[model samples]
Target: MIYDVYTALPTTSVKEVLGTFEKNKIGGVPVVDGKGILVGMVTDGDIVRFLSLQEKVYFTFSMAYVGETEPIEKVLKQRMNTPISEIMVKKNLKTLSTDDTMESALSLLSKHHFKKLPVVNGVGRVVGIISRGDVINRLAKMTSDSLTIS
Candidate 1:
């Protein structure tokens, strides 16, 4: 588990979330409230899905015209100000506790196809984050150590 977890707030802007992801080289973050309670989650996939463009068309008896669409850059710029809460996954969040074992973490990650899971405390405060890579690395290290001659 990564103790130094990066997180976002519900009110955080989409632009800020993108910046966090870029700076930290992460694909997703758990959204927390003011008191650091896990509320939702946001990911690159969510942003991509939310920003998918739908082309509109207008037709008349004598002519057909495609509705004008803004460039992606412009569209992104316009959407940057939107709050992450608008796109965050608010329901059905799966989380882990500090006492959860590595096996449990791996099971949840694989079962739900989650890249990461937030570790929360008794009161629902985020304590850390566990990722698939973290678990795999730990397992590899353990296996190697067990195989090595003392």
Candidate 2:
């Protein structure tokens, strides 16, 4: 329903968005305007791809992970302080209205293979997000109940 969204602003930083995504275990988040309209989306994959293409150094470490970062001050000087607008996907956004049927939502998800779709109003403001996981969870609960009843 309309209660499913975790909203964020477009002005947020790539680093900030990454933290939010990691903490929430979400693939991406909708970037909204003042009126709540969908402006763009930022995904974890986008950040990974952007970083992978950049020059990086590797060092052997006993830990399961290696630290990779450009110094914050140096990064700020290089404008790695750049905002989310630079990296977010701004075109060909797929969205649905609150009035749209569950079948329509499912179809959009199936066709686009999107983990989440922004739910918008007539004026294009984002009201919520419908995710594949949400749909699957709903269906799973329904199936479980039906089995128990039968």
Candidate 3:
């Protein structure tokens, strides 16, 4: 479990979040209230989407894919004072419990291609976070243990 979780509040500004990301080198954070209950999730992607107002898309031979977005720095500075609640992912968040299996967490992460999953307690407060990096490290360790030459 990654206990070094960073957090933000709904009232946190877009610039503040971006600065937090820069300082902490994290792509996202959990948005909590005064009590630290998980109210929503915020990511650099989310902020980018909000700043861009819409995403560009293109069609391929068989399918369509979203195109790249504009640089976020200018917009971040322009809308620096905007509250995070304006763009946070607040509805039907996919979360994990402390007792959840690593397999479950990995499956969800793989399916959604999420960078991190918030681990919550029974009362719905975030306790820790599990990231794809954590899963890969653990898998590497397990494989190494099984392949040890004795």
Candidate 4:
């Protein structure tokens, strides 16, 4: 029942989200609305995919440089300033409820292969995140505490 969590807002820019990710060293964040309702989810992989799939729409700086290859780094940087709402996964989000059993969470984790599951309230407001690391640590601690080393 870890309660402390981090989240992002829909209007958050890709640059700001990247800074959050970099500072926290996290892989993903739940995107919320002004009222803390889950609107979408974003991840490092999402950013990478967005950058990679962008068509090289090079508006020429000059006639001489028309169609000339722009540096990939520059292209990536330019796109990083856009709002995350455009790129976040907003449909069919899977989530856990506050009262859901741990087995249910584990089942979803196993079936979907997600590293973490967002816990939400009845109204789809994010409460916390349950990660694979959290499950493992809790289970390991329980096991170790139950064992009798003679």
| Residue-by-residue lDDT tens digits, candidate 1, 1-150 | 899989999889999998999999999999999999999999999998877665668899999888866678877877889999999999999999999999999999999999999999999999999999999999999999889676
| Per-residue lDDT value at 137 in model 4 | 84
Candidate that scores best on TM-score: 1
Candidate 2 lDDT over 76-138, as tens digits, reads 455444578888888999999989988898899999888888888899988888889878887
Tens-digit lDDT track of model 3 for 1-150: 789789999999988999999999999999999988999999999977777744579998999999876467766667779999998999989889999998999899999989998999999888999999999998998899889586
- Comparing 2 with 3 on lDDT, the higher-scoring candidate is 3
lDDT of 4 by residue, 74-93 (tens): 87778988899999999988
Pairing residues by index, what is the TM-score of model 3?
A: 0.82
Backbone clash total for model 2 is: 3
Write down the lDDT of every candidate, Cα atoms only.
Answer: 0.92, 0.77, 0.89, 0.85
Error of 3 at 141 (Å): 0.8
Q: Estimate TM-scores for all models.
A: 0.87, 0.73, 0.82, 0.83
In the predicted model 1, the residue pairs found to clash are none
**Order of models, best lDDT first:** 1, 3, 4, 2
Candidate 2: list runs displaced more than 4 Å.
2-4, 55-80, 145-150
- lDDT winner between 1 and 4, please give it: 1
Give the Å error, residue 39, model 2.
0.7
Candidate 3 clashes between residue pairs 3 or more apart in a chain or in different chains: none
lDDT of 3 at 90: 96
